[model samples]
Structure formats: C-alpha cells, structure tokens
Target: MADPVKHYQSEGHDALSAISQAQRIAFAPMLFQASWCLREIGVLAYLEDRGKEGATTAEIASHCAIGEYGAGVLLDMGLGGGLCHLVGDHYVLGKVGKYLQNDPMTRVNMDFTQHVCYQPLAHLLDAIRAGKPEGLQVFNPEWATIYPHLDALPEPARASWFAFDHFYSDWAFQQAQEHVLGYAPRTLYDVGGNTGKWALSCAARDPELEVTILDLPEQLALAQPRIEAAGMTARVTGHGVNMLDAEGPLPGEADIWWMSQFLDCFSHAQIVVILKRIRQHMKPGARVCILELFWDRQSFEAASFSLNATSLYFTAIANGNSRFYHSKEMYQCLREAGFHVEAEHEIPGPGHTLLVARPLPQPS
Candidate 1:
C-alpha cells in the first residue's frame, strides 16, 4: 500500500525523511500489534529451549496458544520487523531475537516492558495533562495506582539511566546521589526504588550514607528477585509503603530526599503537598534531589521532541503529565515548599537535569 503521508517536510535529509515518513505511515496499524507478536513468538521459541535450533510456526502456535494462521501471519510480517527469521518452512528468532533465546539481559528487558511498561505506554499522553490530580492507572485499569509502584521506579530509572536500554541506568543512582546532591548531604532515600541500583551505587561509593526504598507488593515481588540477584541486600532494604493514602510518611528524617523520575504524576498542588510532607520528615540540613526533564528558555530540539511525544502518550493512557518544567518555574515551586534551589545541569539529547534542593532552616 502506498503511503498518503510522504516526505513533505523539507527540514530532514531526503533519504531519511522519505524512509522515516513511509515507515511511520506504513506500519501505523501494526504499532500496537508488533510488540505483542514479537514478544509472543520470542517467548514461545524460548520455552522450547531451542537455542539456534528453530521451531515451525505450527509448533510455535500450539505452544503460544495462537492459531496456526495467526502464527503464520506473525511470521510473514515479523520477519521484516526484525523479530524473527525464516528458514524455508520453519521459523525461528532472527539475529535481533537470538539475544532473547536464553539471555537474561535480553529476555528480562522484553518482559519488563511487556508487563510493566506496555500498560502505561498505552496511555503515556493521558498522564502528562492530569497534572497530579488525575493519576495514571497502569496496574489497575479502573482504580488509581500510585506510591508503591512509584517506589519500584528506581530500577527502571537505573536501567534507563543511560539511553542504551536502545529504548532505556546506572546514572540515575549517580545522578540521584553525587550529581543531584554533590556530597553536600549525609543520607539519601530513593522512594519507590525497584532493584536498588541507585542505592547500591550510592552506598558503594559513599560508605558514610544510608539509603532506603519503599514500593508496592507486586513491584516488590518482582524487585525482590532482582535485588537478591544483584546482592546488595545488606545496604538497601525495602519497607512496605503506599503513597496514595494520606498517611504514608517517610520512616525517618534524612539529610536528602530523592525521587528519581518521580513527581510527574501529581497536580502542582500535589507536588507542593509532597514536598511539604517531606519537609516534615526532613532534618535541618536535608536536601531534595530530582532527576527529571528540566527545560529552559533556549531549549534543545532533541529534548523538546522526546518530551512532546512522550507527554502525549502519558496523557492518552495514564491521564498523567510529564510536566516539562522550566528552572525558575521549578524553583518557584521549591520556594513554596520552603526549599532553596541550586544548580541544574542539562545533558544533550532528550535531557534530564540533576536538580538539587537544600532545605530551609527554622525562621527566627
């Protein structure tokens, strides 16, 4: 089928524009199904424990509970999708998918996104505009889900710390601690941390500090296995906490409060309230560190585009907002929460700023 949307934009290179536009319009419908098929077939082949040794589409269909016709259809399209390879009449994972056969590094990512991300991404645009009052319903299709899920966020934050997880973080830990706080504080807490990657890094480098994570039952169920595997169980521990309720206070006051890629799910007032609550749990020298997208007057184009597209997705499915806030604008909010904002650094590509906020001492 010829694409109705052509290379009308003159800004991009002709070759790139023509190919990009055509691909966009060409597989528009398949966008929703593509991930599912790739994941499904990949899992099926893995279940057979066939590494390089392939399986027929009929066998894959039977194992995956999909019809032979459906399996055939997936193979027909998935080959070009870079998800599978065709061996005459038989089908197997392609070069791209060979990684998924038994590699924990490969399969873990697909599972994480399919189970954890697919739902929220289903409504990424909806989350951006909710502005805090309307929360994203990722786990629950009907009810509002927050806090515990928010706690487990750090692992994904860690996994996604860098741009390489292709579509995904050791840096969230480094940024959460060193870059965000700059060693000005003594203790740090990563609320909703998943695998405790941030804390592991923080504790490894700074032996003087203590870090904590709070998350939900389900996320913890998944995170527990990973945390144990990572073997940082001594430095990092989990506390059962829920943020949606009115009474989920910090277990103790700390020198710093860290919310990695957190705080985007609430309204402005909600952010103020959360900060104020942190104020109650904070010591005189406490600090707040946030790793999020911080925009400025002279905006970077790549950062702008990623934020725009992602915010839209947040709004559509999650009924939440990304809140691409400016520096002074964020400082205003921090001031209202009784904190003094410090420096903000913006790296290249859909940038995330390491923002540090030092707490205000008592007034005379």
Candidate 2:
C-alpha cells in the first residue's frame, strides 16, 4: 500500500500530548473547554459553518465567543493541531475537517463521562485526604446506580462514547486473543458485556468460539435490541444476573472467562471471592481477562488522567477500591486468587490495559 503515513511532525499530536500530560486541575477551564471542542475542531461540521467561504479572525472569534487575543491563541493552537486554515487575513476549517464532525462522534459520551464520571473523580484528592467522596456513605456508584440510568440518557449521550462500541471492544478482546497465542479459544464468557460488543467481536473472528454475557436484568433488557441490531443474534448471547449476588457458574461449562471493566465495582476481597467462584467453573484450561485502567507509574496522559480520576470516584462514592490499580499491584491480587499471568497487552489509544491469566497450574 502507498506509504502508511506522510507527515511525522504534527502539531496536533503535540497539542494532544500536552492535554494528555497536564492534569485536569492544572489547566484553566477555558482551555479545557477548548480542548473539549477537539472532536469538532477538524471536522466537516465546522467546515459547513464556513459556507465554503473563509472568514476573518475577528469573525471567527465572534463565532467562538472570545477576545481577539484569546482567539488568536485558539487559532494558533487549532492550527498546531491541524484543525484550522489561516491564509493571510482569512481563516477556515483545515483539510482535516472533512473527517470528523465539528462535534465529536461521542459528544454525548463526553457529557456523560465529564458530568457523571468526572465529578466524583475530581474528588479523589479529597477522598484521599478526608477519605471519602463528600459525605456520601459509599464510594462506588457504578454498578449500584449507573446501570439504572444508562438507558434513560438520550442515544446521542450514549453514542458520545466512541470507545465503547469498537475500540474498547477490540482492546479487551485482542488482549484475550493474543494472550492465547492465537489459538482458536474454545469457550469464552464475557461477564456484564452490555451491548455484547466484545463478545460479538470474539465470536465473529473465531467461528469455533461460543460466548455469553451475564449482566443485570435491566441492562440486558435494553441491550438485546442493540445486539440484534448489530446482527450478532447467534454469535453472542446474554443472561441476567446480579453480579454482586452470591452464585455459581453456568450449568454446563466454561473454558475462558472475561470480565472487561467489571471488577471496579467491589472491594479487593470481594473481587477475590468473585474470582474464587469463577475458578470453579473453569474446565482446567480456562483463563480470564480483566480489562480496566490498571495504572502505570512511568508517565500519565490526558486519557489516563481521566480514566484514573474516574476510577477514584468509584473508590470514594461506592467502593474504596475504585481507583485504578498499578500493574504489579493487580498481578499480586491475581496471584493471591491462584492466577498467574499468561500474557499482557496495552491497547492502543489510552487508559486501558488487559491481563489474561489462567488458574496457576496445579501440581500433583
């Protein structure tokens, strides 16, 4: 194929790097809001607003609502990010504007994450200090509360989360597929896989596989339509269960079990107990994939910061263990539960890692 890429020194990439590095608290809210407009910046909707005619800097500033000085900076920053056109005194959306909407595909997703996920997240420092999220009795409201209202939000809000449908699914499934060393895994189970995104992907790629998702009645009720809408009526299936309830595995069998972004709802002891229960369902060759924001110490990025902060909200409001785990720390927990790592992969983009492990081989 023609060269994979043509440009190396992209200012947009660098600007995002700045966004990824700086903590949410460090930037002025104005800049943060501008950055929030990122998905829309180099998108077609922005171009449409120009009506095929470019405008002066003052006009652009008037449109975006800011002073001339600030607008100049915004234009420069957008240019650095490859989202603006500056030809002499006139400006327009950049060439990149053809692809993304002036608004992001996940605008609604951003609102949900920003409003629901970030508020409690911002309280992490306070939680660490006062040791709680405000005066709320619990720290983790994810499973307990998030489930009931997910469908209540408009489709655009849910759709705002671009990662949930494709990228996130791939990140979690590829970890499992690669961890198995490319073998056609026999049986894989995705617990609480709402919308069956990951399960459907796994089943599609490997025809020999059978996958099931266990989730609450309400989520499953809402998710069935989407699953059918995606035409994954057979490759993937669902079951309703209270994940927190004491229970045993499915009646017949399980060779591999996957929990993507499911463990953050409980305490470590609770997770251990859950794993212990899941262990009994394995057929000697089984492995489990745990996908979440297992924190890394090397460096932090914007997505990572957002993810880590989101988890902190879980810790403060629902369960104390809501903050993301360090890799080594999670491995320790896995070890205590009789699982040793078989493989690990950090998916592309940000704020997610996958750990796949089998029950430690028992010796005779």
Candidate 3:
C-alpha cells in the first residue's frame, strides 16, 4: 500500500520559513483571540462593508463604538495575522477575515473553540498525564465525560457545541440519506443516535421504515421530544442504554445498523466491544453502515488539519480515549468484530466516507 502520510514525511520548509511557522504557532492563541475580538466588536463587519475603499482606524473605531486605541491594537494584530491589510492608511478585510466573517463552517468552528474548548484546553497536559478529561472539570467536577452534561452547558457553549456537532454531520446526512435508505430496510437501528437527527431524517424519507435510536438515557431524553414533535412516536423509539455497559440490553433485531460519527467517541477496544455486542443480536444478513470523516482520507490539507486538531478536543474535553480515526484503524476494528467491508462510498461535499459491512460467516 502507498504511504498515507507521504506528504508529511519531511520538513518541506526552509530554515527561515520553518522559524516563521514556529512563530505563528507560538502566537496562535493571541492571534485567534484578536480575530475573535475583531468579529465580536464589529470591526470586521465594518471593514467588510467598506469593501475596497476600506476604512481608517479612527473611522472604524467611531463606527464600532470603541476607542481608536482599542481599534488600532486589535487591527494591528489583525494585520499581523493577515486578517486584514492596510492600503494608504485604510484597513480592508483580507481573505482570511472574509472567511472568518462569512463562512458557516468557520463561524461554527470558532464559536465552538471559543465557548466550549478554550478553557478546557488549559488542562490538556493534565488530562494527558492522567489519561482522563481533567479539563472537563471546568464544566462539572463530578462528570467523567462531557457527553451527559451537553444539554446543561452554559449559554453560548451549549448552542455552539451543538452547532459545531451538527454542522459537519448534518450536511453529510443529506447526501448519505439516499445511499442508506437505498438498502430498502424495513427496520434501522441508529446506534449512538445523538438527538435522533439521523433517525428522524431517515424516518421522514421512508414511510415504511421504523427507526430505533440507541443511546444514553440523557441523550434519549433530548431525542424523544423531537420524535414526538415530528409525530414519529409510533414508528420511532428510543433505546436508552449505555453501549459500554456489558450487561445492557442488546440492540433489537434490525435490517440495518447505522453509526454515524459515533465510533470515534470510543477507544479501539471499546469500539470492538460495542460492535461485537451488536453482532450478537443483529439479524442474519443485516448490514452495518458507518459514516466517518477519516483524517487521512481528506483530499485537502486544511480538512485534514481540522480533523487532527479535533482529536485534541477528544483528548481534553471528550472521553479522553477516542479521536477522529484513520480508515485503517476503523477497518481493524471491524475485522476484530467479525465483519468485512463490502462497499465504500464517499459522500459528496463534506468528505464523509460511508462503509457498508456484513457479518463474516460463523463457524458451525
């Protein structure tokens, strides 16, 4: 097999360029904060409105309701960070600034990073040393993971958290819906059905389909009302049980078992256990479909960079054991759980790959 990481094998930058990159990394937090302030304080918006004409520092300050000194300092960092550029004493929004101001993905990522991941990241080293989400204590001292406390997170954190979560998966769902429903399965089990978003979407598409959401009771509590509101109470149901609990009720028989962006929340061993347990109860010839964004599979360096950085969030704020996986790792997990990939499809737009697998034949 060709090397998956061939591009990252050597130092591609000259010494001066390498040092410049180091400086950028060293000042990343400060620059990020400056960019945030630029957006929140409306400097970016004002500059964007000015277009090519741009605006002087004083004009920007006057419009944004801040002192010229405040505006100058933030705009200075913005220039340093390439969020804006000055031409003839006028500041114009740069391409980076435009994306920061306008891109939905960028907006969701920034909000999530600022509101949910920032404070927790301070304890990243401690979490690494302890092999636990030590930073999660910032939200609740008693909680071991952030999943259960998701709904109760304060203010913008809750909103940003869900926005970031749904932004990636929801878009992919639009493309994945057709392929999954194409199986023509009468019953589908949505394992780790966070908020029943996938289950409801599928249920809405196929009138004959009956969907079951398997997830934590806390998540189930949140999903049940949505199902009721959608008037899917009769065909959709919640199975509130932790997959990690070995003694928990096995998933009921289903023609299709779907796990979308779910197994990444678990360690390799945990994933094997969960899949093995599902294998025990899945009906004969039932198929398992997994939707994931493998870091190594991304065509763009930026997308891969995003996925790799997201792994740190898993370590510091999530379960502390799981991360965005490479395709090989997931394939190994499937093999260990007695399945083989029968087909793979790349969903258009968001770079999500869906794997369809069936159980290996059992010994007599």
Native-vs-model 2 lDDT? 0.60
**lDDT (10s digit) by residue, model 1, range 53-126:** 67787778777778888777766676766667666666766766555455554455455444445556645444
Candidate 3 residue lDDT tens string, 116-180 = 99999999999899889988988888989988888988988999989998999999997888888
Off-target runs (Cα >4 Å) in candidate 3 are 1-4
Clashes of each: 34, 17, 0
- With a 3 Å backbone cut-off (N, CA, C), the pairs that clash in candidate 3 are none
Q: Top TM-score: which candidate number?
A: 3
Evaluation by TM-score, superior candidate among 1 and 2? 2
Candidate 1, residue 242: CA error in Å?
3.0
**Candidate 3 to truth, TM:** 0.97
TM-score of each: 0.57, 0.66, 0.97
Q: Predict model 3's lDDT versus the native.
A: 0.91
Question: What are the runs in model 1 whose C-alpha is more than 4 Å off?
Answer: 1-143, 146-172, 175-177, 217-221, 244-248, 295-299, 319-329, 347-350, 361-363
Better of 2 and 3 by lDDT: 3
